[model samples]
Target: MFAADAASRALGIRLLASGPGSATAAVVVTETMLNGQGSTHGGHVFLLADTAFAVACNAAFSPTVAAAASITFLAPTGLGDELVAEAVERVRQGRSGICDVTVRCGDRVVAEFRGNSREVHPRAQRPE
Candidate 1:
């Protein structure tokens, strides 16, 4: 799934790790990812987290998509900060799942993201 993520790939999001129910990704803050205030845009931060969430949710082998997602910005970051997002499945029941992601630059927490997922194709059973 990461290999086919065109939007995230176009924005320079790279997979750091992926497993059954977890994933990590990194993105370097570039000039293009900044806002008018010289800080990295919130959208970009959420994108980083979302990318990791996508990888984690799909790691089950069954295709899934975000049913809902929300992000909270904890700190500001600027160009050259390599933001890393780590996602882990929080809970899974029936056809729904929850995942939490933490975005960090060095040791500072930059943002937090939570994604709710639903399987898009049920025929593909999620691998345990």
Candidate 2:
């Protein structure tokens, strides 16, 4: 799934590792990712966290999509800063799951994200 994610790839997000219910990814903040205040855009940070959450949710499942997600920007990052996002599954029951992602720049926390996921059944993939 990571290999096929063009949006993540386009943003230079690298999948560092993944397991049954966890994933780690990283990206370098670039000039294009900056906001007018000379800091990395919040969307970029969310994207990185979301990518890790996506990988973790799909790691041991057939397929899943985020039912809902929210993020809190704890700190700002700037150009050339390397950010890493680690996502861990908090709970999973039936077709619903919850995951949390922590985005960091080295030892400093940059953001926190929580994602609610729902498995996409094969039947749902069929064209109506």
Alpha carbon RMSD to native, model 2? 2.0
> Per-residue lDDT of 1-119 in model 1, one digit per residue for the tens?
99999999999999999998899999999999999999999999999999999999999757889999999999999999999999999998887999999999999998999999997
List candidate 1 stretches off by more than 4 Å.
Answer: 122-128
Q: Which 10 consecutive residues of model 2 have the lowest summed lDDT?
A: 119-128
| Candidate 2 steric clashes | 0
What value does the lDDT take at residue 75 in candidate 2? 94
For model 2, the local distance difference test gives 0.97
Model 2 over residues 1-128: C-alpha lDDT tens digits?
A: 99999999999999999999899999999999999999999999999999999999999997899999999999999999999999999999999999999999999998999999999876655566
> Against the true structure, what is each candidate's TM-score?
0.93, 0.95
